[model samples]
Target: MSVHRSALCRGPYGGEGAAAGGTGCSDPAIFEVARHGRPPLPVCPVHLGPALLMASGVLWPPEIRLIGRVTGLRP
Candidate 1:
């Protein structure tokens, strides 16, 4: 069964939530995603960046679906 737990934000501009009730963002302590064999990892939407933003490539057409297959993550 899947578990629910708070996760710390891993964004580049994260880690300002533990200030003992200070006036700062709470780092969006959200749930985690873990596979049965893999360990739990924090997923911050802020740092994920655009879903498709190829910087420099030389291909007729980028296979975007391949990413989901390789990483087992849904688009």
Candidate 2:
């Protein structure tokens, strides 16, 4: 059972309700695969610039997602 907690991936599909806290957190927390935890939004703070302007106030697609060992930022 893969959990979304916000499950806010880079695509436009899964972020809606989870980002709005329906799944658990409007501001979901980011965790290492098993190491540490941080707030998910700031995890990809630079990526969130557009999200800030999106007027939707979703909780992800942020720069904090790029931190440490995330996969979406890679080529």
Best by TM-score: 1
Deviation in Å, model 1, residue 60 alpha carbon = 19
- Per residue, candidate 2 scores C-alpha lDDT tens digits across 1-75 of 135444432322123344533223233333311112322333123334433444233444433233333445557
Give the best candidate by lDDT: 2
How much is 27 displaced in model 1, in angstroms? 2.9
TM-score of each: 0.24, 0.22
Worst 10 residues of 2 by lDDT: 31-40
Name the Cα RMSD for model 1.
12.0
Model 1: per-residue Cα lDDT over 1-75, one tens digit each: 123233443332222247222223334434233223323323334332321122122122422211111223587
Error of 1 at 74 (Å): 22
